[model samples]
Target: MKKIFGLLLVVLAVFAIASCVSEPAPKKDSPLDATVAYPPKILEHKGTAWGANPPAWLMEALKGYKFVERMADYQGKIVVIVEQDGESREGAELAASRLDAIPRISTLMGLRVKDTFAGAQVGDKDKIETYMERVVKVASETRFSGFMMEDSWWTYLQTYTPEGKADKRTYRVIQLWTMSKAALEKQLDSILKGEAANEPKTPEKERAIQAVQNAFYEGF
Candidate 1:
């Protein structure tokens, strides 16, 4: 009886040790669950803005790359920047594929900014300035010149309840502003040179410039 009791105690001790051994926490389905210093900011413009954390698979794919910054909701459109070290067409293609695997991400445009620019540290003033400077400097380099601004818009039907009655509304508006690195440089130069005022403008163009500025200075 004593030997049997000792055996049971040994088994319990083994179980206790097993329980104490920590396993890595399971990755969350949503990227929002992952801890980030600067959480995603609201993409303020018009219409309802919807944002969510990236999935576990995305997080894994983004590993070894520069960083998977927060996803933004620009008036119902989603935008994300996946920066990678060096310039690899193959790598970018693979990354694009990974991003496309996500349904929401696939719908929007993906801009690939290559080489030597790490995202600024959260709340670091000098780091932020340095990062932006580097981005601009890189932009100025003639070798990096695939920047273009795409003015693409789409409308969708939104259902809502008004006074207990179901109603549907169709929104017709330009929802996203995606700029290439070259285009971004041009806009930034225009803004810095006090030329944005001189250029013929629309509300959407103004917002796009502001959004790009904010993305650099404040992070997505």
Candidate 2:
């Protein structure tokens, strides 16, 4: 009877071990696991996006105004956004000449104009959209990193024109700003370095803009 009792005790101990082995261990929190959603690296980009627009006529008329034959070292990587709205040739010429006269406008501000342009016609319906798309395309095709559409001229014309269509023309022009993206990395680098930090941050975007304010100021 003693031997049989000892054997039964041994059998119970084995069964107990087996039951513990079948159950899974609880999962513990890992320190590294919590930060899986964080981005691998931060991208610091320059914020201010300078813009310029020529009349529609010159934008369409001028051959290479839309293209960047040689990329200038203006405002670091702050992309220069230029719009050649070539609707009116004569007006476009006047605008371009005036814009060119403003020293450092192209280099520091990153905005330039080749000329003034005529507003899109009412009967054409899709003229403004088509023209703006072309402007965006030209900028990209020429490897320009950013874009800006100035409908200031268009607004003036619409004031005298009939309702509905006046606002219609300007809406597409406004939409261009959202559609464009420019790199300001180079410009940001210049401003963040030294004296450029002293400038006021009026436009929130300009807060991050770092570069020579104009061509005259030399940044060390």
TM-score of each: 0.21, 0.17
Q: Candidate 1 at 140: error in angstroms?
A: 20
- Estimate candidate 2's RMSD in Å: 30.8
lDDT of 2 by residue, 1-220 (tens): 3322322232223223231112123244568653222111101101112222333322322232232212231223222222222234345434533442122233323322111112222232232333323332332223222433322222111111221122211100100121121343333233334323343334432422221122212321
Candidate 2 regions exceeding 4 Å error are: 1-87, 99-220
lDDT tens per residue, model 1, 106-214: 2221123212223533233332333344444433432322322222222222223422232443322221223343444464454333533543466655654344455
Model 1 — which ten-residue stretch has the worst lDDT?
Answer: 38-47
Question: Which candidate achieves the best TM-score against the true structure?
Answer: 1
* lDDT for residue 187 in candidate 1, whole number 0-100: 44
Q: lDDT for every model?
A: 0.31, 0.26
User: In model 1, where do residues sit more than 4 Å from their true spots?
Assistant: 1-153, 156-158, 162-164, 174-176, 186-220
